[model samples]
Target: MKLECQEKHSEIRNGEIHVYAWFFNRNVYENNTNVITFNKIKSERSGKYTCVARNKAGFDSDAVNIIVTYPPIVWTKDITFNGINRPRIIKCNVSGVPNTYNITWRHYTNNNQLVRVFNNRINGVLILPEGETNDLVFEDSGVYRCNVTNGIPDESGNLWQSKKIQVKVEGKPVLAKPLKSTFIGHFNETSSISLFVLSSSNVTQAEWKAAENRNSLGHGCCSSTVNKTSFNGKCLDMSGYTCVFLIKNTREEDFQNYTVDLINKNGRNTFDISLISSGVPEVPSITDIYQRQNYIVLEWKPTFDGGAPQGFIVQYRKKKDKNWESIRIQSNETNDFVYISKLKPDTEYELRMLAFNRLGNSSFTVQFTTLFKGETKDVWTQFNLFLCIPIVLPVCLFVFLLWYRKVLHDGIVTMTKVWLLDTISIFLVTEMTYIPR
Candidate 1:
């Protein structure tokens, strides 16, 4: 294929004439001649081609569109439609040159017989039951094939392209197996438990209730209706035939065996699930510590709540003091940091942090020295130094000086001197160690 642009004469004159340049789809064609040639072209090369003649005064250009034609390609996928009572529309996706085409729909039956369902110029066909208002039946389930042709033949000389779709029509309500039957939740937290049902028709009525006892009832529950709006829990309609029982705020009493009853015209079914309590929360870790004026701000990252709603408790005390000051945070609070105000500057204080729920609590402890009123360095650095000194110094002194001091002093004064030198070296090394900011 080739494209050529001829120069046309005009009365207006330019300073100097230049060579012609060629372009395809707004991109420069490597060939700078007036004609663009292709030994063999594919569909991708079809687009607008332009030729431009330039001079010192200005430039002029012209363009022409190119198109490639191909045979029809039909695409289809298997579809499963629940609620057989409803009408459905089945369609095949087709793409090719010449938008106009004829579509043929055929069904392959269980007896190995081929039957033509529809033959028309439309892309899609509506499927209904035998009667105008009748419901679809299981006999409607089969392999439906769609053939499309636009009067164009492929390279292999095949005029029609075909695709098949497996249609399934189901009936009766049955339990859709759940991944797990038990859910762990915390008190005062929100939880949604889902129960899926597969049926040919919509679930006209659904009942969500708590069982008096799970051990006594094997399939059904004695109704302590939790689906009412007045209660803490309610039934929510979900897509894909799922019934969700949402507890807005779970309580200790809400942790029990639950049942979901699904009812349609054809049949009814029930499913059971259990909501259990979680254990104590994991220990909290201090993520950051800084000082502002006389106030110390401590930030911590909360750990897993063991499937329950949890809150934080911060306790702090002066290093020389025995009693601790406590600050409790509620679960609904969003603040991740606690501000300890009116603290003595340049004084070391021990801090204890714990996460607690109704179940129990876990705690972590650290020590930080407050910064001076106008100090810029953070309390985190001081905390790091304090952590090393208090822990290492006491343990080292107790093991080396207290336990072996008498023996060395009675017989080997040189050994005692060496031990004292080692202890001093250890203390200096610890003090010089890098402190976390």
Candidate 2:
């Protein structure tokens, strides 16, 4: 509040005119002339007052009134609303000059247009306090400003004081991306399953359950962790809170369906993860391989199925390389043979096989190398026997016939010489078998 007082005289003493002023009927200024002012004003300063101008002989008195006007203060804080709960009401606390203060509430719509809102402002019938909103909805969430003014003219404009309240509508836990239904873990190795849960608040309570019992996973073999963050397209514009479960030193018994229950003030939801353990199938040993043009057909004894219906995967590469190329066979039944084609001619290659199922994959069997071309030859083969027999038989027959003729000629010459000496009439005595000359 400001005030001015002055005395007009024909002459002035000490270059100033003295005036007296009384605030609320009390003398507050007596030595000042031409001006009396209250620099700052408060509510308590509202009252009647008077100012007097005095000279040596006479004094003039004038009556005046002073009224101090100020702005209202709004008592407010952050507000949260549970959309699922009934009778959701928010209160606005305001204090100022009692009858002079007017508290008005306004909020911007989605299009940013200012609109007056009256949400159950009546008393008794409506639980929401005056200048507040009731039955909160997601659409009602925004920046709410309470403008308090006493309609009194002051340095500050029409708005005396303003306060903003951030209101958010929180609903129950809704699963945006739930836990995976199936998980695979290797024997003796640690495995983890993670779930992405979206909630309105940072705090969410989670529990593990299995086999119709609560907390059955136990602390020694199982553990879990949670992290809160914001996500973009996949989370549907909501903040994503992730929870992960770890199984240590995985065993066969750990292969089962585990449930995770999440709860908050909004609501509750549950999801499951099925864990399975897989081991390598038994080593595969080769029985025989038939060679074709740049291809080979392989036959083998079926190895152990490793506790599941299994299929085979064949991998091969050059003998000098460590990187292997693979061939996949999609079948659950055991296979006794597989035909491998498209091999490089004259190139040495090492090959291996593995068995796999939905549970897990097996370790690769021991590697075997393919034979190069023209390396297969046996002395007992039919081609070698026919070539050797014809050349050897004629040489043996010629040597035996020469030896028999020499022996027969020598015996016949000796017998004829002895018989001719006595042989005038000897032809009748001994009949000799004729020898051809």
Clashing pairs in 2: 172-266, 172-267
What lDDT does each candidate get?
0.68, 0.58
Tens digit of lDDT per residue, candidate 2, span 1-437? Answer: 45666555566664543446454557464535445556767777676667776656556777677655556656777677665544545556665554456555665432344434544232212133222122232434455666666665446565656677676668655444322477666677787766666555653566667745556553222122233222111222333465667888987777888887777666666666677665556656667766865577777676765545677788878899889988877755456777777766677778788777666677777888985463345657655456544554454445544654565666754657445533622442222222222
- Least lDDT summed over 10 consecutive residues: which range in candidate 1? 225-234
Instruction: List ranges where model 1 is wrong by over 4 Å.
Output: 8-19, 25-31, 39-41, 55-58, 110-112, 125-135, 173-437
Evaluated at residue 49, the lDDT of candidate 2 is 67
- Candidate 2 has its poorest 10 consecutive residues by lDDT at 228-237
Q: Residue 276, candidate 1: how far off, in angstroms? A: 54
| Candidate 1 C-alpha lDDT tens digits along 1-437 | 88886657655466545678878899988876777777886667778888897777878899999887777878777777655456676778888777778888887643334534677847555464354222233335567888888888888999998888887665655543223578786668787675555455577766776777533322322221222111001122212355666776888888888876677776666667799878888888888887776677899988888777899988888888999898999999988999887677677777778899878887565655443354456678777576876566666666665545575567656866777767775775575563444
Model 2 segments beyond 4 Å from truth?
1-19, 24-31, 38-47, 52-61, 68-145, 148-161, 165-205, 211-215, 218-240, 244-437
TM-scores for all predictions: 0.36, 0.33
